[model samples]
Target chain A: MRDSCSRELTCIARSDPRIIILSGDIGNHMFDGFKAEFPDRFYNCGVAEANMISVAAGLALSGYRPFVYTFAAFDLTRCYEQVRIDVCFQNLPVVIIGLGGGLTYAPLGPTHYICEDISILRCLPNMTIVCPADQAEVMASLRSSLDHHGPMYIRINKKNEPCIYTGEPDFSLGRAQLIQDGNDVCIITTGVLLSEVIRAARILEERNISACVVHFHTIKPVDEIMLREVFSRFSVVVSVEEHTLPGGLGGMIAEWMIDNRIKSSDLIRIGTGDYFLTHCLSQKEARDHFGISADLIAGKIADGLNK
Target chain B: MALAAKISGNKYRSFVLMSDGECNEGTVWEAVLLAPVQKLGNLIFIVDNNGWQATGRCDDIMHLNPLADKFKTFGWNSFEVDGHNFEELLNIFHSIPVDSEKPTAIIAHTVKGKGVSFMEGDNNWHYRIPTADDVTRAKAELGLE
Candidate 1:
C-alpha cells in the first residue's frame, strides 16, 4: 500500500505541480523515486512529526497540496495536537498518510502499533478518515484526495497487503463498496482486513448461511446509505477491522444503529480486545490472538446468527 | 510556505509571530532546523521575548536567553530589536533576507504589558482581564484618558 501510495503520488505530482510530499525522516528509500523526480517538492522534516504536520498545514494553506507521511502510531499519536489544531481545525487540504495502520508493525512493539487512529480522528470535524483495503484502493484514495476539500487521514498497511479489489472498484470518499451480496449476514469491514472478512464470508456461505461482504474504505462520514440498506436488509450485520473494537468499524456501526433507531439486525463487532499486546507477535499471529482470523470471524458470525 | 512561495516563483513572504514561552516546544526547534536547510529567505520568524511565561519567567523556567544567538548558531540570519518600537520593527521587516540564502529570525525584546504602569512586567496580566476600574486606570497610565 505504501508503495502504491508513493507511485501514485509521483504520478499525481507530475500533473499537479502543487503536490508536495513531506516525511518525518522515515521512508527516505521508499520515496527515493519521488525525490529523484521532484527534489524540490519532497521535504524530509526529520524525526519531528509535529512540525511536519504544521509544515504540511502551512503548505496547504499556501494552495499547495501537501501529504504528510510517517508511521501511523507516530504520525497520529506524537503529533495529535498539531493534526487537530493546525490541520483539522483549520480544515486544510493536507492528506495525512499513516503507514502501518493497526498491527502491521506489531513486531516493532506497541509503540508502533496503532488501533485508535480511527477513533480519535473520527471525532475531529472536517477530518475524513480512509483506510484503504489494498493497493488499488490506496491509489484511488490518493487520486480522490486531489479533489477533496478538507483534511484527510489515509490509514494504510506497510506493504504486500492482499488485494481485495481486482481493479479500482469505483472508489469515492464516504461511499461503501459492496464486494458480494447476501441476505442472512452482512460483513462490513475496512482496511487490509477486508481479505480476512471475504474469506470469512465464503466460509459462512459454505455453511449454508448467505453472507454479504461490504468494504468500507472510508471510515469517517461512513457510508450511511449503505448502513441503512445493510441493516434493513440483513438480519445479522458484522463489522470487522484490524483496529480495536472501540471507535472502529464495529463501534461506528453500533452507534449508527442506535442513532437511526434500527434494531432489526443483530450487530456483532469483531476487532482487537481493549488491551495492548503483551507478547511480541506478527500481524497474522496478533489477528489470530484477537479472534479476528477468517475462521474465527466465521465462527463469531455463526454464533451471532444462532443467537 | 516560504519554500512553497520560492518554488512557485511567488514573491510573497511568510511571517510567523511566536512567543518566547513557545520556544520550549520541540516543534519550534524542528522548524528552526528546517528553514535554514531549505534556505527559505522568504520566511521570517519574530519572537516576542517578553521574559514571562504563563506561570513564571521564561529564563527562570527554561533559560531561553541569548535567543538570537541560538537562531544564529542554527544557520539563520538573526537580529535583536525593541518589539514596542514600530519604526525599528518596520525597518527590520523591510530589510528582510539580510542574507539572500538564509531565513530570518528576529528576537524582539518586550515587557509583559507595555504602556500601562501597573500592568507592565506583570506576569499576572497573562491571564488577568482588566475590569472597568482597571481599564480606566490603564487608560490613564497610557494617556488614553
Candidate 2:
C-alpha cells in the first residue's frame, strides 16, 4: 500500500508541481522513488507527527497539496488536535495515509494496534475516511483521495494482500460496490475483510443460501442511496470488518438503516468484540477467534434464519 | 521596509499577524522573526496569551516567563497591556509609529473565555464549543437582551 501511494503521488506530482510528500521518519523503503523523482517536493519530518501535520497545514496555506504518511496510531490520534484545527478547520487538501490498519501489526503488540483510529477520526468534521480492501482498491482509493478536496484519511494494511480486482475498476468517493448478488442475505465488508466476504459467499452457496457481498471502501459520506437499493432486495444484512464493531463499517451501515427509516431487517455485525486482542495472531486466526471468519459468518446466517 | 524587501529580491514577504496561543508552531515563530529582519515595519505581532495551552497549564511545557522580554530581545518595540480594557488596547495601538519604526509586539493579558461564567479563565474552554444552554445563560448574563 505504501509503495502504491508513493507511485500514485509520483504520477500526481508530474502534472501538479504543488503536490508535496511529508513523512514522520517512516516510509524509508517506500518513498525513495518519490524522492528520486521529486526531491524538492518530498520531506522527511523525522519522527515528529505534530510538526509534520502542522508543516503540512502551513504548506497547504502556501498553495500546496501535502500528503503526510505515518503509522495509523500516530498519523491520526497523536496529532489529532493539529488535524482538527490546522488542517480540517482550514479545510486544506492534506491526504493523511495511515499504514498498518486494524491488527496488521499483531505480533508487534497493543502499542501498534489501531482499532480506535476510525472512531476517533470520524468525530472530526469534513474529513473523509477511506479503507481500501486490497491493492487494487487501495490504488483506486489513492487516486480518488488525491483528486478530492479537503482532508482525507486513507487507512491501509502493512502487508501485501492479494489483488482483489483483476481489471482496473473505476472508483468513486461515496459509492459501494456490489461484489455478489444474493436474495437471502447481503454481506457488507470493509478493508481487507472484503476478501473474506467472497470466501463466505462461496461457503454459503453450498448451503443453498445466497449471500451478496458489498465492499464499502469509503466509510464517511456513506452511499445511503446504494445501501437503500441493496436493502430493498435482501432481508438479512451482515456487515464485516477487521476492526471493532462500534464506529466501523457495521455501525455506519446500521446507522444508515435507522436514519433512512428502513427497518424489519436482521442486521448482523461481524467484527472484533469490544476487547483488546490478547496475543500475536495471523489475520485469519484472529478473525476465527472473534467469530468473523467465512465459515462462522455462514453459520451465523443459518442460525439467524432458523430462529 | 520596502527598501529591505527590495534588497532581498522576492525570497520572502511579511504580514502582521493578529494572533493568539491557538497558533504557536515554528512557522509562526519564524514569521515573527522574519518581519524585523526583512524590515517589514508594518508588521504587528500581538500575543493574546490568556495563560492557556491545550492539555494542561502552559508553564508545565516550558515557562514562557517574561514573554514580553523575549520580544524586546528580538529588537521589536514591545508593550504589555490589559486585554479587556478596550481603551488601553486602542491607546497602545495608537502609540506605535509602525509606518517608520521596526516591528511591534503587544502582549495582552486576559482570560481564556472572557466575559462568561463557568468558562472564563479555563483552558478546557479553548476547544469546547459552548452548548446552547450555556450560550443562552452567557448571553443573558452579558445583557444581550
Candidate 3:
C-alpha cells in the first residue's frame, strides 16, 4: 500500500507542481524517490502531526493541494483538532493519508491501533473518508481525491497487500462496487476487511447460501443510492469493517436504513466491541480474537440467516 | 510553502491570533520553527498571553513563562504589549521592526475575563459565558448606562 501510494505521488508531482508532500518525519526514507524527483515539494515536519496538519491547511488555503502522510495514531487522533478547524472547517484541498490504519500495527499495542479514525473523522463536515482495499483502489482514490475541493482521508495498511481487483473496475467517487451478486444476505465491507468479507462470501456460496458482496472504498458519501437499493431489496444485510461498531460502516448503513425506513430481517454488524484491544498480537490474530476474521464473519452471517 | 506560494499569488499578508493556553500543543512550536526557516515576514502572529488554561493557570499546567522570550528563542522577533490597548496594537501592526529577519510574534498580555468586574481573574467565567445579569452589571461598569 505504501509503495503504490509513494510511486503514485511521484508521478502526480511531475504533472502538478502545486501538489506538495508534507511528512510527519517518518516517511523521508520511504519517499526518497519523491524527494529525488521533486526536492522542493517535499517537507519533513518532524514528529509533529498537529503542526503538519496546520501547515498543510495553510498550504492548501494558498491554492496548493498538500498531501500529509503519517501513521494513523498520530495522523488522525493526535492532530484531530487541527484537521477539524484548519482543514475541514476551512474546506481546504488537503489529502490526509494515514498508514498502518486499524490493526496493521497491532504488534505495537493499542497506542498504534486506529479503530476510531473513521468514526472521528466522519464527524467533521467536508471530510471525505476512503479506505482503499488494494493497489488499484489506492491509485484510483488518489486520483479522485485531486478532483475533490475539500479534505479527504485515505486510510491504508502498512505493507504489501494483495490486489483484490483483477483490473481497475470503473472506480468512481461515492459509489460502492458490487463485487458479487446474491440474495440471501448482502455483505457490505470497507478497507482491508474487503478481502476477508470476500472470503466469507465464498464460504456462504459453498453452503448454497448466496451472499451479495459490496465493497465501499469511500466510506463517507458511501454510494447511498446503491446502498438504499441493496437494503430495500435484501432482507438480511450484514455490514463488515475494521473499525469500532458505533460510528463505523455498520452505523453508517444503519443510519441510512433507519432514515429510509427500510426494515431488514436482521442487520448484523461485524466489528470490534466498544473497547480497545489491549494486548500484543498480529493483525490476523487481533481480527480473529475480535470475531471479525473471515471464518467468524461467515459463521455469524450463516447463523443469523439460518435462524 | 503557504508563505511563498500565497504571498506570490496575491496582495495580502496573513495575521494569526491564538491563546497562550494553546502553547501546550507541540505542533505550535513546530510551526514556530518553520516561520523563520521559510522567512515568512508577511505572517504576523499575536499570542494572547492570558496565563490561564482549561483546568488551571497556564504556568501551573505548563512552563510558559516569559512567552515573548520563547518566541525569540524560536528565531522570531518577539514583543509584549497591553492587548486591551487599541493604539498599542495598531502601532505594532503598522510596521515590522527594522532589521527583523523572521516573522513577528506579538505576545499580548491580557486577562481571561476582562471588562466585567465579577468575572475578572476568575476561572469560572473562562468556561461559562456571561449570564444576562452578568452582562447587565458589566454594561454598567463599562459606563454603557
lDDT of each residue in A49-138, candidate 2, tens digit only: 788899999998998989898888778776888999999998889999888878776656666767777777777899889899877777
Which digits, one per residue and each the tens of the lDDT, describe model 1 over residues A162-280?
Answer: 88777657898999999999878889999899999889888988999888899999989888998888887987788888988888888888888889998777888889889998777
TM-score, one value per model: 0.69, 0.67, 0.69
Model 1 RMSD in Å is: 18.8
- Candidate 2: which stretches are off by over 4 Å? B1-145
Q: On residues B60-112, what C-alpha lDDT tens digit does candidate 2 reach at each position?
A: 43346577887778777788999889999999888877454477788888777
Higher-lDDT candidate among 1 and 3? 1
- Model 2, residue A245: what's the lDDT? 85
In lDDT terms, how accurate is model 2? 0.77
Better of 1 and 2 by lDDT: 1
**Candidate 2 vs. true structure, TM-score:** 0.67
DockQ of each: 0.02, 0.02, 0.05
Tens-digit per-residue lDDT, A105-158, candidate 3: 888888888788899988899999999999888888998888888899999997
The alpha-carbon lDDT assigned to residue A94 of candidate 2 equals 91
**Could you tell me which 10 consecutive residues in candidate 2 chain A have the lowest summed lDDT?**
A23-32
Candidate 3 backbone overlaps, count = 0
